[model samples]
Target: MTDTHEKRITQNASALDLAMRLRQMISAYQVSQAIHVAAALGVPDLLQDGAKPCDHLARVTGADEDGLYRLLRALAGVEIFTEVAPRTFALTPLAALLRSDVDGSLHALAVLNGQDWFWRPWGRLADGVRTGSSVFEPIFGVHFFEYLQQNPAARGVFQKALAGASSRAAVADMYDFSASRRVADIGGGHGALIAAILGKYPQVHGILLERAAVLEGARRYLESAGVLDRCDLVESDFFESISAEADTYILSQVLHDWNDEAAHRILSNCRKAMASDGKILVVERVLPESGVQKGPLMDLNILVLMGGRERTQKEYEVLLARAGFRTTRVLEMGEAWSLIEGVPAE
Candidate 1:
């Protein structure tokens, strides 16, 4: 071939590769939905025994055979499952995470993504960006938490999803709970972090402060974890008041659901309730100064769904200061979260 023709062909190949990459990015949501559907259908749980042919899986899952086969085939290409034979599939390591019984399961997260209450606002991302506000209330006709209060099923899915996404075990170990006699987990959903802390420190008692609707789930979870006796479940609004006399206050992944003004109110309430020598731990994903990270994505998610945003260390310091507490130190917990410790400013 001529030199000029060879150069043109190479350039064409590169352009084609670029196009394919862009196309994949454009259609990435399809893959996410497919994974959600598979999880919703209990595909991973079904495959736990062994590999199953598409027909059997479809019959068990109540999915159309041919359509399910195509779905599995596409997912196999993405390495979620392996196509070991024609129309037969087995779970990959990634697919194993969708099992509800697993220790670190993503099953609930997947189901949440597919749920109407969670996914609808994502459809209005452009509107949220334009208005600099959450689309959740507009889309659902009520505030996110209010909607959850009314819809028990959605609340269950959301709480389970939160449980799946938490680094509670890690956050529980980041500080010395031995010094704390009473740890109040303000707005703590289902009592995961507090349960972890109480489980670790047998001498420490806990107070889980959450809405009345959520206290039952928290009670059940704390009970199952065998820490129910050590915990006092309080059904109250954190913005209005927090339980008094707690030496340690935990705001686990809670503040990020509200804007600055609301977050400050919650913190101020905690400050009012806390003992003079008490410490407050804000466990959240702290945004880094530069470069790309999941923090930005989570920040956008907060904006789109809840009108909140992740903040940097300086922002946290300022916020804490505004609430009459000063950030003493930041403990780096892996996986994009950090424990921002604060003490009363006095």
Candidate 2:
């Protein structure tokens, strides 16, 4: 009944709340795995019409009925699904985005992240941080890209997941390409970004430079986007050299896959092949000085899986300066992406 006792009780309650919140954060991976299981089993797609009994879902997905019901109830607790009836579940707004047929579906993204091959490396993140090296090769016995090259199914899933992001068009709109005669997308996976650029600026020709393994998919994608004729697909490695010269170059989500030295090398290669008056558009996530951004977590994911780091704005400026380019400006493309524009230094 005293003021002191009341204050002490409030403080204790706050401490307990903090503890409870931290506990949820620590165990968030269980939710991710549950979503992955539901997506992998096409549960969202099955629920597209309406709510379905848990037993029916289990029968169709070939899952144990009791296990499926538990999974649904847990997800319902998180509001991903709704328990409309005793044993029936339906899609929540969040769950609808997991349906594969949707325009901006995250089905592939969910499936890819939960894959054992991709998930295992994240478990050894401590080793990666301690040694400042990629943990993927040690666990998989090969580089991530090489593993993708060898595993067709995984590569397909990865590419699909990347394509599902829907940022390429937004990236194209972030900058003006009307003045550019030719734009080359270096290390462009499946040429999606370039296709978006070509689609946006019909006057601007596009040249897609990537590894030989990627050109086929790039060709198919560009053709599907109706930009194949306007875009030239070249098979080459950016680390070694850029075979084509263009007035504008785009490095979309590419640099964050390598360490500073390697990223610098790729930039230098672009510098060499680019026209004297050309500009390079480095499309990537910019880590903020202070705040909660996906950039930091993605940076760690890159460090563990690809040995790369997400950089602050100043870091990108310094990195550009080292590669014989000067930072001109950075434009916001959308959430999760930024357009860092640089020109050859005088």
Displacement of residue 176 (Cα, Å) in model 1 is 2.0
Task: List, residue by residue over 270-292, the lDDT tens digit for candidate 2.
Answer: 99998779999988888887877
Worst 10 residues of 2 by lDDT: 165-174
TM-score of 2: 0.95
Give lDDT: candidate 1, residue 67.
95
Top candidate when judged by lDDT against the true structure: 1
Model 2 residue 2 CA deviation (Å) reads 1.9
Runs of candidate 2 exceeding 4 Å displacement? 291-294
> How big is the positional error of residue 111 in model 1, measured in Å on the Cα after superposition?
0.8
Displacement of the residue 182 alpha carbon in candidate 2, Å: 1.6
Q: Determine which window of 10 residues in candidate 1 has minimal summed lDDT.
A: 163-172
- 112-209 per-residue lDDT for model 1 (tens digits): 98887787898899999999899999988898889999999999999988876657778777788888899988888898888999999999999998
